[model samples]
Target: MKNLFTAIFILLLIVSCLSQSTIQYIYNPPENIKDGLDVGTLAEVNIDSSLIIKAVNKIYGGRYKEVHSMLIFKDNKLVFEEYFSGHKYKWDGDNHYGELVTWDRNMPHHIMSATKSISSACIGIAIEKGFIESVHQSIFDYLPEYQHLNSDGKDKITIEHLLTMTSGLEWDEWGAPLSSSNNDLVGLWVHCEDPINCILERPLLDDPGTSYTYSGGNMVVLGEIIRTATKMKIDEFSKKYLFEPLGVDSSTWAQKFDNGVIYAGGGLIITPRDMVKFGVTFLNNGDWNGKQIISEQWVEKCTTEYRNNKGINIPGQASGRHGYSYSWWLKSYPKSGKKIDMFNAGGWGGQEIMIIPELNTVVVFTGGNYLSDVRVFNILEEYILPAIN
Candidate 1:
């Protein structure tokens, strides 16, 4: 009995050590980039390095059971970049029962709601190129079928309202059948033959711009609006204006249904490295490698909190320690009783692109937490943030 106990204890120790090593492996900066540029030389930001390491360790030890990647950049140089799991690109097509998946630098994973941020960027580009008239323009102007609806108050809805998630259109963001009636806009993407028509048909639950409701329906509507205004498919416009410029050419955009439109709210697949590039672009204020991809004005407007959802001053809200800006989330914390501005692009599961503009820093994290786990955020706040310090 004593020998058996000793063997079991040794086994547990080995498992624990292996787990710790895995965490370190994922957080390690990419070797090629590290050799080319020193992360320490990137910029001057006061971060506790030990805290950052602890944060990374905690996240990896948590319940997220999929590939994870992160990158931190300050100034114009790469500070940190790394990947975990031999499974870099874990898609529906790649995962089969008991198959040993090997993922590396080039593997692409589904980004989920992070796509909303990218879609928002596309809209900003359209606005800068004169395709979109203004944020105040009536949405019906782009989708004329919406004009037939007896939506008197709805007509007052503007592009800004939708971008800020204050459109007041009824929507249940949480995918609960019991909660479906809270927002009549549920299943618009999956059920409707015409997404634009489905969105226009939703009944107004409150006056436009009066409340805050997180709506995937709103994002689908924005995608339709971009398609109409630009007279191009969402995927094409994204490629020409956003992806190609960033040198990210391998990502795939999945549609909700066969012969249907791309799922603009969440269904984008991209590499972890490419995801970092997207965050870095925002950190650089919409420029990439010396070229202006998105207008500086658009970046400012989209990142700043545009409306007060209910009583919540979005940027001042405590939920996720962030505020809603267009499709981005503005994360801030009170330092000495004053709110400091930080922002992030987040997705369902554990995908995040956190930016601290004051520090000229950007961090990206991706994982598959889904509904089975909620510890990923805890890891971010308690472990990841401390490690960067």
Candidate 2:
């Protein structure tokens, strides 16, 4: 009987050790402070590790099964980084198929429409450096190729309208499934020869800047403006000002180009770790270490909730109401009173770079569940935030 009790005690001890959680990090300390993220313990960062472990298990075991990677940073140090194997949709000759892929610490994942936020940042930098005058300046002034369309209500469109997605062009990207031919962005991509010309040629559905209308054409136009302003491609400009400054030069950043114009609406591929650096830079008010990669004023304007469109039911947005900023998505957590202020760069298939200034935390996600991207909010609320002390 005593030996039986001793065996049970040994089993319990093994279970206890197996259930214990620790922060598993992948970054190596570089000689340059700007080259890598600092690492810390969940306890030291004031986070509950056991709870975080449960969150990671939920991501991999069943819940959020489509998540490719999940990362969290607090106090400017990486606390949790986890990757999962999943399948990505790709074209195979005549049809699309799910290609099995393994996500790790170093692989670059597609960010989809999150590229819009990065493109907006480039425009802000261009404005600060005097490459572009201001967001209020007419977009037509820069694109003489579309000067013919400036006669009607299109004449009222400005750079701010494009950034805010209030340009009110006849767009139907959010109105239909991406696989459907009716989706405007997909149509523009597949059928149009020049996406910029395709967007500019469309008649205005509403007066510019009066109401909200999510348009990829707005982003395509911005990409051209950046090229004209900086006299360089989007990739080149980002390398010089954004990626290199943050020590993300090793990353594989893929940008789409049609007829020499980068597809600014989407098609940016970056690693989950580098995405966290971006969130941290914005959390630190656009400063990376000691260098100002993006101006503080631009960060504030982009993150600020410029328009509150709550209670409006938008298709695919499970959360009924959300505010819009320059190119960032804004929504409060808990969906109730005394909410936690949060802003994110969200993309199709659940790519996110979430920033919560109140908690000094940045959460990054790369997912492949295109139909249910909003489900990540549940993971954030039920698991991630609860893991915080």
Candidate 3:
């Protein structure tokens, strides 16, 4: 009987040691004064550090390859930040390629279609500054140069329609891979002589705001409108109104093949740390550090749309079809058998900024999963969300 008691004591001691080992480790990201983001330990935000460590281990363990960076902001403080070495997306005329590179806090990563969200913010800023009147204004009001193409209800397209991607332009971007010349988005920047004219000349498939479609052409048109109304280039406008105010570390926007026109649809290249700030701004109802970046009205409108009307199927968006917002993808994450309200600005090759208003959290990721399956959503659903305390 004494020997049995001794064996039981030994088992208890082993289990206690295992439990202690699991909870003993914690990760605290370093603070950078220049970054302008307040830093705090994950414990302060009631996040499970062990889960984050497990997620990082899976990343470094090669379970989720081609991931470059990950960051988490909870309660307006950056609680976790991490970077990894992965492939970066590079492009030729129509072909997309990749190169293995080391990622860091300062490397500016191309955000692809995520630039549309920033462009949406630009539109809100333009309205706040009285560049144009409102989103109800016709696109032709700013693009009178393309007034010739206004026949057959094309002239009826409004800025709001463009923001919601209901412009009704017959654009074929998702029909083929971007590397194929058949993709209209690739042709607009590469083969077409004039992007604005090329997109504007497309036939109107439906009356504006009647159907849902995902096209980068809508964002390009909005960029032109911003330029026309603000009397400045998209890059300059963003720096002055968006990036500068948000304190972005560094950024670059790619231009047209042979012109100065910026591809506001997918041109932004910024560090992952800087990229998440935009989501934070939206989470705070268009306010950043006590300054009203965009009005609260825009924020509410940006997230109001919750219908996945057309059964949009996007790679890396395997949480089923997501609803469209003003350049934002409205989604709900399933947690504890209930869906949590969430939204994101996702781009090709795994660049993403996901915000959960219910949790008051923002998650950022940058990767090079071009033309391939991505592990981003899996990481979020499995590791990140479960880490919340």
Candidate 4:
């Protein structure tokens, strides 16, 4: 019994030591770009390095399985950055299970529904540039091509309804996994030659703007609106107006599309570093460096939660419920006994870009923990916030 106990203890010690070396790097992140971001040490930023290290250890120890990369920007400096190995996939049309590959900082991870937030930005830009009329305008005004879909109360649906996911269209994106044919998203992806028109054809189960239903179809319509208004696809429109202004490399960001039409709802591939640039832009009130890429008013309108209680209660979030804005997510965390609101662009399988306006912080994460149930919010609440507290 004594010998068995000793062997067990030794095995545990070995596991612990191995976990400690999971992310073998110093906290002093390198200054990769002179004009892009300034790098600094954790002490320079006044964060408790020990706490951050503990969190990373836990992630590597399988507490947060399959995290690919984490980058934190605070006080105008990139302070802590880390990467880990994990399995992730690329979607190839109807396969559902696309090419599986190991994730790394060099490899761009699919941002999933976070694409909706980017699509939202494109909509805002279009409004400012006169490519789009107004969020209050009937969506059919922009989509004249799909004018036949206007019957059955669908004509009353405004761009605002789609933005808030309150279009009152019957959608089953939340009930089943995307892999199941029963899921509405799968049906939207598979069934039609004209996917946007198919979404419009969905039965209006409730009065427009009266009910909140999570639907990717809403985004598809928005993307098509941009495409219709401008003579370019949504991806091309965003490239010229949004991406280039922010100094994001063209090669680093790509939108997934069917043939030539970008969905703008769930398919975007971006590096974690580039993701932080977006968070900074929104946090800084639509300004990138000096240029106003998006209107300040639009930024406020999009990020602000609608008055009508159309929010979602996240499963593992300690905050309980989160509000939905024009594609952005709104939640508040208790920090040092004060409420700190968070603006976020979140995606399926753990991709996120989180902005703490109060803290002057932006955190970016990319992972493929679709089924793990390990939330970045839990990590933020327990370790990240407390370190700076």
Tell me the tens digit of each residue's lDDT in model 4 across 199-239. Answer: 88889999998877788889988888888888788778888
Write the residue-wise lDDT of candidate 2 on 242-275 in tens digits: 8888888644435454676777878788888889
Model 3: per-residue Cα lDDT over 1-389, one tens digit each:
99999999999999997875565324667576657688888889999888898888788767876788999999889989888897667675222556667888878899988899899989999999999899998899999678888789887899999988888889887788878778998888667877888899899998888888788889888989998999998889999999999998487886554656778899689988888789899999998989999899888877877344445668555557677888888777778788898888999888899999999999999987776677788899999899886
- Candidate 3, superposed: residue stretches over 4 Å from native: 1-26, 93-95, 306-311
**lDDT comparing candidate 3 with the true structure:** 0.84
List where candidate 1 sits over 4 angstroms from the true fold: 1-28, 32-48, 63-67, 86-103, 175-186, 310-321, 334-339, 374-380, 383-389
Q: Model 3, residue 206: what's the lDDT?
A: 86
- Would you list the C-alpha lDDT of every candidate in the order shown? 0.68, 0.79, 0.84, 0.80
Tens digits of per-residue lDDT, candidate 1, 222-287, equal 887898899887888999999888888777887564446667888688877778788878888898
- Tell me the TM-score of each prediction against the true structure: 0.81, 0.87, 0.90, 0.90
Ranking by lDDT: 3, 4, 2, 1
Comparison by lDDT, 1 against 4, better one? 4
Off by over 4 Å in 4: 1-25, 90-104, 250-259, 315-319
Q: Report the error of model 4 at residue 281, Å.
A: 0.3
Identify the leading candidate in terms of lDDT.
Answer: 3
The deviation in Å at residue 107 for candidate 3 is 0.8
